[model samples]
Every structure is written in C-alpha cells, then in structure tokens.
Target: MIALAGAIGTGLFLGSGKAIQRAGPVGTLIGYSTIGGLVICVMLCLAELSALAPVSGAYVRHAEYFVDPALSFAIGWIAVYGPCVSVPSEWVAVSTIVRYWTDLHPGIIIAICIVVSFLTNIFFIRVFGEVELISAMLKIALIIGLILFGLVYDLGGVPGQSRLGFWYWVEPGAFGEGYLVGGGIGRFCGFFSVLVNAVYSFAGVETTSIAAAETKNPRRNIPRAAKHIFVRVFVFYILSLFVVGLIVPSNDPHLLTSTGNAAQSPFVIAAEKAGVRVLPSIINAVVVTSAWSSGNHGILQGSRSLYALALEDKAPAFFRRTSRWGIPYLCVIFQSSFMFLAYMSLNSDANTVFGWLSNLTASSTLAVWVVVGTCSLRVRWAMEAQGIPYQELPYSAPLQPYLAHVVTWFSSFIMLSGGFYVFVDGHWNVSDFFSSYFTIPLSLALYLGWKLLKGTSIVPLEEVPVGTFIAIARANPEPPLRKKKGVVGWFGRFWWD
Candidate 1:
C-alpha cells in the first residue's frame, strides 16, 4: 500500500500535464508504457532478491553482501538523496496543489506539509503504514474514478459535452513538435522528455522492499507487493494518462501554464471545460492528499536508507539510534531538515522549482535502479557459482539476469541522455543540464573515493555468501499466506489482503 501510494503521486496527478504538453497524446502513452516496462523489470529483479533477503535497505544491503561494500556505500547515499530532494518536490507540488483553493505562500505550505509528514513518520511503523494505506486507497479510488470520468466525458456521456473520441490526438496529429528543434526531431525530443517525467512517476516501485525488515512475514509479503506494483503502475498510471490524453488536448495552453493548482491538471481542465465545475476542486483536494502522502513516503525511504547505512558502518553511528517504538528518530530528523529545500519555491516559480527538483530526483532514482539491476545480476551469478537451484529460493523472478541486463543498460542510457535537449541549438540551460547529469559524476566520485580509500574489492562470485542467507531464510520460514474467505475475502482482494 505504501509502495502504491509512493508510485502514484504528483507526477501522475500534476506533473503529467507537462508530459502531455511535451509528448502529445499518443506520445504520452508511448513514453509511459515504455518506462513502465522498464520499471516492471527492475521490480521483479528486486522482488526475487528481496524475498530472499528482506532487509531494511532492501537492495542496498543486497549490494553490500552480494556485490561490494564500496558499491553499496555509493548507492546507499544515492538512495538517501532520492527522498531528500523528492519530498521537497512533492511539497512543492503541495504548494501548487493548494493554489487551487488559495494563493497562500508556498513556504508556509511547505512548512505545514513538512510538519504533518514528519509527525506521521515519528510514530510506530504500523501508524505510518496505516496512513500510507489510507492514502493509497484514496489515490487508487481517485484515479479509477477519474479514468471512468474521462471515458464518460470523452464519449459525450456527460449531458452537454460533445464526444471527444481522440479528437485531440487527431487534430494534434498524435505527437508534439519536438522540444529544442521542432518537426521530426522535435517529436523525438518531446517523447524523450516524457521519459524523465515517467521515471519520477514510477520512482517508488523499487522502494517496496525498503521496509522488509519492519514488515511481518516480509519474505512473503514483500514479493507479493513487488509483483503487484507493475499492475498498479499499468492500471493507475498508464491508463490514467491515456484517459487524460483523450479528454484534454495536448496543445491546451493551460497545460504549460502550471499554476500548481487543479487548473494545471489535465482532468480538471477537461472537467471545467465540459461544465463539470465541482470535480476540479475534488480532484485538487485528493491530489493534495496524494502529494502529501508522497512526501511522507519519501521521508520514510530516505531515513531508512540512512539508518541502513549506519547499520553497515557506512554512516555516522548516531543515525542508528531509535525510539522505543523502533522509529529512527535521529534519521527522521536529519531527513526532515532537507524539507526546508522546498522553501526554494518561495524565491522561484513553484513550477520551475518543481521541474528542477523532479529532474534531480529522477536522475538519482535512475542511478539507484542501475545499481539494483547490477545487484540482481550479481545475485544470479552468485547463485550459479554456488550451485544453488532456483527452486530453493522463496520467490524467484523469471528471466534471471536477462531482465537485469536489459533494464540496467536502458536505465544507464536514459540517465545519460536525460539532458540531451539542453545541448541542442537554442535550448541550453546550465541548471537544467546539471540536473540531468549531476548524479553521474557524483556517484562515480563516491564509488571511486570509497574504493580507493578503503581498498575494497568486489566479492568473487563464488564467495558472495548467498548460501548463508538462503540457509537463514530456510531455517526460519514464514507461514503460508492466508486464504481469503467469503465476502470479506473478496473485499480484501481489492482494498488490501
């Protein structure tokens, strides 16, 4: 549920307008679907390993054990960095989202959101889970309702609106003029731009296992959640974007003028245009909740990543301190401090700040996924070298190292090319360019600095200790997943199991 909430946030409800504006209707679908496929591959890879290990930092721990300590050190900090910037991005979304109701200063809104999300995480883990679970349910309900609303409105099921049946797609000719250049090359640029936004939308799928150490029967539940993430991404994210493209024209001027309110949402734009006055406020309200939930999700992941680093002696020992309820209060406080970065929106346009922050988050997330893919491949190689059969694993993802290779290479390409438009004639922006490629050098420096300083070497495939963890899982196996019974069971399938 937390993962679901994390995956469907401002990127879907708010930032997607930018995607449609740049990519056009068909291009939006294509970009989301392509990135969605890559996310699925990475999720499955993480699922197989996480179900076996089920540690606090998920892949970070896996990399340390199965890959190298230095790689883990680099990627661990990157993981922490993901949420530090990401939460503020969501808070920036909150600043704009609340604009639907009023023009309250974004800094004030940022402070309120930071306080609320911080308090939510300062409790027991279950309290945080329930909050996210409710947020997830609300988000799922909102997207499904919006998708249905889009279909009805587009087909002229609403009393007065005329049928829109791909009118935007037909008129816009199915793609936006490419970004830097225009015409054919611009069309490609537009589609490529959507990839980064899509990465931001899908960033949370890989985080499901970060809570494995805190989850009950995580070996079973963690894989179940990971497997379900792809479906959620498809149904909620891809389908929602498809519906948005249908009802709202890609060329709508409102798409580009992101006011950080419901006015910027494509669905709200459709609703207001079609004389459905009430829906925009409602959509905006839910989106505010969605963005706030995403902020909470980011802080949770960030603090846990920091805590995991301390556990591995990769960070200051103070981060390992916890409350009686097992909450990492120190780590949470440290991460919450980064939320002040949201105040940057007070100085710049909230939309511009959002773009910068989202770009940074997406780039770092791509780097983390690359490391995850590497860890997945290493795990497979270790298993092979140790003569362990796949059947012995608690959960096994099909396709083995092939999926890992494909996603790793693809993510690397996307990460490197994220700022390609900035280099094109008449399109260069120094800040934008750095946001795209900054993580590349930062990650390399961290890896090399640690490797050179510590003289750490990659663990040989034959000595990765895969068998030790496998034995631990075997010794203390979890109970089988309970079967749902009768009406309650049917409801459980939808709400949560």
Candidate 2:
C-alpha cells in the first residue's frame, strides 16, 4: 500500500490533465500503459535481487557486492536525492490542491502541508507504517469505487444517462482531428510530449523493493507484494485512464494547454464533463487526499534512503541519528526543510524550479533503475562463478540473466533518449536543458570525486566485509519468539522454580 500511494500521485491525477491535451486520449493511454509495462519489467528484476539480499539498502547493497563499489555509491547518492527533489514537487502539488478550496496563499498552504508530513514521519516506524497502510487503503477504495461507478454509469444503469462507449471516441476521433490543426511532425510532437509526462506517473514503483527491508518476512512476503503491486498499479492506472478518456473527449474546451494553469486535473475535468452533479467536487476532494498521502509517504521513503546511505558511511554521519522510536529524525527534518522551500515557489516563479527539479529527479530515477537491472545480472554471474547452487535458491527470476539484460537496455534507451523529445520540441531553454541533463554529469562527478578523495578502489566481492554488511542488514531485527512455558501442574517443583 505504501508503494501504491507513493507512486500514484498528483502526477497522474493533475499532471495528466495537460498530457491529455497534448496527446489526446488514445496516445496518452497507450503511452502510459507502455511505460507501465517497462516499469514492471524493472520491478521484476529488482524483485529477484531483493529476494537474494532482503536488506535495508536493497539495490544499493546489491550494487556494492555484485557490481562495482562506484556503481553502488552513485546509485545510493541518487536515491538520497530522489526524495529531496520529489518531496518539494509533491508539496507544490498539495498547495495546488488547497487552491481548489479557497483563495488562500499557496505559500502558507505549502508550509502547513510540509509541517504535517514532517510530523507524521517523526513518530515510531510502526506508527508511521500503520498510518500509511490506512491512507493507501483509502486511495485504493476510492479508485475501485470510481471505476465501478463509471462502469455502471456507462451501462445505462444510471437514470437519464445513455451509454457513451464510442460516443466521445467517435466525436473526437482517436487523435484530436482539428484540435491542433496543420498536419506535420509538429502535430505529432504534441502527442510525443506525453512520454516524459508518463515517466512521472510511474515514478516510485521501486518503493516495493525499498520496503522489502522492513517487511516481517521478506523471502515469503516480498515476492507476493511485488506481484500484487504490479497487478494493482497496472489495473488502477489503465482502467482509470480508460474511463476518464471515455467520459471526457480529448478535445474538451477546458482541457489545459501548455500555457494554461497547472492547477487543473484531468479527473476533475472528466467528472465535470460526465455531468454527474457534485461528482467533480467530490473528485477534487479525493485528489487532495491523494496528494497529501503521496507527499507523506514520499517523505517517509526518502528519509529511509538517506538512513541507509548513512549506515553504509556513504552519506553524512548525522543522517544516521535516530530517535528512541527508531525513526530517522535527522533525515526527516532535513527532507522536510527542503519541502518547505517549495512554498516559496508558491509566491514566486517557482514553476520553473519545480519543472527543473522534477525533470532531473525523474531522469535520476531512471538511471537508478538501469543500474539495478545491471546489478542483478552481475549478481547472477557472481553466484554462478562461485559455484553457488542455483537450484536451491529460495526464489529465482524467470528467464534468469536474459530478462534482466533486456530490461537494462530498455531502461537505458528511455533514459538516454528521454531528453530528445524536449530538445526536438525547442523547449530546450537554458534552464530546461540544464535541469534535464545535469543529473547525468552530476552523478558521475559526485561518484568520481568521492572515489578520488577517499583513494578507494572498487571493492571486489571477496574483499568486501560480508560480516559488516550482514550486521547492517540485521540492525532492525525482528522480535524473537518466546520459549514455551511449562505447565504449573505439579506445583513449584514441576515449574522448575
């Protein structure tokens, strides 16, 4: 549930509003489901690695042991930056949600949201987990209810509302016929604009692997959870998108353009179009809940990534500090502090800042996924070379090294060419160019700089301290079982008093 809440956020709810305008319904749906399949492939690769390691650091630890230490360091630093960049973006999203309710200042709203999210993370780990579980449940219930309601409405099950299966699709055709008139690549460019937009919607599916560390029984639970995540995310995203497209024509006049406001949400627009009185307002409220829940969970997961880095001495030692309740208090405070700055954008031209931050972070995440798949392949090879018995492995990835390799290349192609759409569209202004491309160089620079300063070579598996790594993995050990108590049947002597 934490994984679901973290991944499906304002990116899908609100950001898709603009995407629909650009790509039309058919293109946007195809683009989202395509990217979703790729994300699932990446998740499958991570699942195998998680089953092998099942540790707090997850992929980072696997990278260190199976691949080069430099790869581990690079990916770990990127993981730390993930939430640092994402929390602010989500804060801006929540502020936008509040704007729907009143004319209150966005800055003030962003501040309040950040404070609430930070406070939630400051409690015990179990308490935070329980809260996230409940929030996730709410989101799941809302999406399921919406889907069922839309299905029933489409079947003419609701009074005075006729079925609209091909109505909108026929009216608008597949692509917007006259929407962005003048045929050429320019028209097609608008459709391809959704590629980057889709990436954001699929962002945090990796959280399942991240949470594997804290799961009570990872070997048994992690794979089950991963499969569940794949099915639920795919269903919710594809079905919700299909329903929205069916109800709201792609060329709806109110659909926001690139120059339009960021506060618009596709779900809101679709509900309003369906003419189901008050449904639009209800969806707006649901979206607000979704944004708050997303931001809260992002903050939680991001801090833990920092804690993992600190434990490995790859990050500043201060991030390792925890409260009595086992919460990474320092990291949470640091993460929330960054989120507060998102409010400043509320008053300024922070949209540019948000755009840059989001692009860079999304690119970094794709890079991390590529590394994860590559590291999995390396782990399999190392196991084979060491004469490890694969047959006895607790869980094995289907198709072994081949699927991992293919997915690695697939992710690499996406990351490598992801910037081209923006570039070709001439949206490559100085800020956008730097924001989109900077993470690649910055990650490499940080990794190499740290290596040069520390004078450390990439540690081989044999040279790496297995005991130290295992000790870190076992830091937050599960509770031990109580010994069976003997009956007091024969008085004190029988009780071993």
* Candidate number with greatest lDDT: 1
How do the predictions measure up, each by TM-score? 0.93, 0.85
Q: What alpha-carbon RMSD in Å does predicted model 1 have with respect to the real structure? A: 2.8
**For residues 87-146, could you state the per-residue lDDT of candidate 1 as single tens digits?**
999988888878778877777888899888888888645677787889889988888899
CA lDDT scores, all candidates in order = 0.86, 0.71
RMSD of each: 2.8, 8.2
Which stretches of candidate 1 lie above 4 Å from their native place? 123-126, 258-261, 477-497
Across 81-163, the per-residue lDDT of candidate 2 in tens digits comes to 77777778877776666666677877787778877777778864567667667767777777887788777766666777788
Worst 10 residues of 2 by lDDT: 488-497
TM-score of model 1 relative to the true fold? 0.93
> Which candidate tops TM-score?
1
In model 2, the Cα lDDT at residue 87 comes to 75
Query: Candidate 2: deviation at residue 473, Å?
Result: 14
